[model samples]
Target: MRMYYPYVNAYRQNTPNDHNGSNQVMTVLGNGSVSVQPDVANVELGVITENVSLLEAQQANATTMNQVIEALLRFGVPRENIQTTSYTVNPRYDFVDGEQIFKGYQVSNMITVEITAIDQIGSILDAAVESGANQVNSIQFTVQNSDTYEQQALQEALANAYDKANAIATSMQVNLNPIPFRIEERTDTMPIPFSKLALSAEAGATPIEPGQIVIRATLEVKFRY
Candidate 1:
């Protein structure tokens, strides 16, 4: 006996074409970014180590670091600007005659200092060294409020996008500004959290250079004209 099947509506049909349709609406979404190496600034500081007995080493490092902090404070570095990056005690090893022995205890302390005065980077380093900072670990120059600069960049990017759109519109003999159906702002900083670059101030005066910051934005414009 023959069996009868229920009629399937074209709308409800689960055919391949219906389920996975691919007649894409040709829409152009271009992305552009503006980057400015804004003035680079950061905590120009260091870590000092004095290896003796662990206790003495700790005391010495503490004293020196305190002096450094004081000098920085005198140089106008605010209390809140100082960040204690690290502190630790490690055993120093001495190898002799094919034998390894404990030489002494090394005490190390690190503090991050944010110096806003770009002009005094050299003076600050000299002061830190004079104040007893020995082991210079890391010195980094970074933007204090990158967000503000980044926003400026974003605005520039939007303007760039507008420029591109207008150019395209002019080429097509149409005005995009009023003919666009909609203009949506697509903004971002690429990486959410920006990491500051680290440099060593052990050699030269803390290199405080104002470079540029990178920022970007995109706009999806439907220009009917």
Candidate 2:
């Protein structure tokens, strides 16, 4: 019991033992958020499919896919981040008189690139186009990074909490101990998961935009006499 008292001392009226000299010490959490709707930027990088033969088709698709990756690398995109999101090597089926016939294997490899630089998006797309990446995917605006903004939001939440505590304490005619008796923060902000984040990679330049991203944080502080 005696040891736990120190935790609350910081908020109590200042005394010789409590260095916090009653400076309206009330525990509060403020909330803040920074957002910027990024300009549209994107380029779809994919392989073209042509069935010369089942094996030849696969080989050709792989070669073309590698060219696209090379183009991205040339544009300063990290090779590791460029991933093959889709791959398929299947025979094309044509039904004649309800009879299915295997024409040839349609092999294709499609990669998804996480473009970090907004400005380079257009250029990257252009490069993909020049590198024989003809199939354009979906594109749109979204947030690439949210950790910094999330921290900002947390600060704002703390401020809000402090204001609330002060108003309540003042209304009760209490000095609010000028500090927080108990400070608690609980937030479930999923930091930019791959699943939750995305920009359309549809065909035709995939006009993409990393629009404004919203980040929120909440804080709870309890003040005691």
Candidate 3:
């Protein structure tokens, strides 16, 4: 993250009347935002296997997860970008006539795949499901270089603050300093979620829309006249 320092002008000369001890300061709040399409997609997909025997369920889940990873690799995703997010083995049970009946063992293996190519998300989902991925957990779209956009937003916020302060000074018939003595930045970023995902292989090629992400910046500025 890049930090922005308070702006001070070297050419401005202060007189005795412009003493720092004077409480003649104007405070203003400014906001700025930028919207852009996300450059990266994170998809959480995995396999869930169930069997009467615990060993069989584990083996089945492992085999399916391996195949899914291989398919992702062949589809242009880097090996390092694919990571196992969770793996668990649990016993399945059912309530029959108020009696707990032991069903089987269920094994689930989930992995998160980072895709830099945003346009290939649909095809990637199809490939994963075809290769044995049965569960599609979530999909999130976000910017890869968020710092750059945040910096731009900060600059815009500062500009907005200066404009508001100058307008206020003009209305009060007082000279306003172009430079702000203090500035505080507050940034907020929210990732876009693609929640409507289908994991069935019969659904054919899935259509994915990354949409747009918004980067917002708020600044509190204090200026002296």
Candidate 4:
């Protein structure tokens, strides 16, 4: 008896039956991907303030961040959608003549805002910046309902695996089982971040383009022939 095992891209492996008597098994890997427009966006923006005194720096950062949040709320963003992601105060230092000199305290406050209306990302970013937001960190795009797309991708992957296995069996003149004895799914869904954006708070109505998001699924199937 003989067995055939196929890896990625339909690479075949042949083995003579020595162990397991006359049992013959075939293994193959399949991959599928689906791309769709993102439905949601998360924007990370904040304010940074520096002052000689730590208390002053903290107070300034708090005031600016409050203004930014209020602006976002007035622009139709729900209060619950805005959440603080990071808040830190660190001492600033400078090297003068091979000596470390204390400069001031730097306070940074960052918030993540979730926007369901994808078209309004540019306007919202403009609003935040106009209201004392100085630091624009990043933006991430994702789909709200990912389970549906994942299932579709999985189905496509299984179909692909079946096709490959059938082709191998036909070429080798052997009987192939239509049903796989084992199926393993490897799926990964992640939010795509748009980091190459040219951002300028001073520029009017910053242009933001949200690209398509891709969901991928991989499967390893084993069949008896």
- Using lDDT as the measure, the top candidate is 3
Task: Put down candidate 2 lDDT per residue, 56-171, tens digits, no spaces.
Answer: 77777777777878888888888766777787777788899999987767776777777767877766776676676766565544555555666677667656766787787778
Position 57, candidate 4: lDDT: 93
| Alpha-carbon lDDT, every model | 0.58, 0.60, 0.85, 0.83
lDDT of 4 by residue, 49-155 (tens): 99999999999899989999998998888999999999988999999999999999999999999998899889989888888898888999999999899878877
Top-down lDDT ranking = 3, 4, 2, 1
Candidate 3 residue pairs in clash (backbone atoms < 3 Å): none
User: What tens-digit string does per-residue lDDT give for candidate 3 at 7-58?
Assistant: 7452255534554566688999878888978999888988999999999999
Measured on C-alpha atoms, candidate 4 has an lDDT of 0.83
User: Higher TM-score: candidate 2 or 4?
Assistant: 4
Number of clashes in every candidate structure?
13, 38, 0, 0
Error of 4 at 112 (Å): 1.2
Candidate 4 worst ten-residue window by lDDT:
1-10
Show the lowest summed lDDT stretch of 10 residues, model 3.
Answer: 10-19
Task: Output the number of the TM-score-best candidate.
Answer: 3
Query: Residue 39 of model 1: what lDDT?
Result: 40
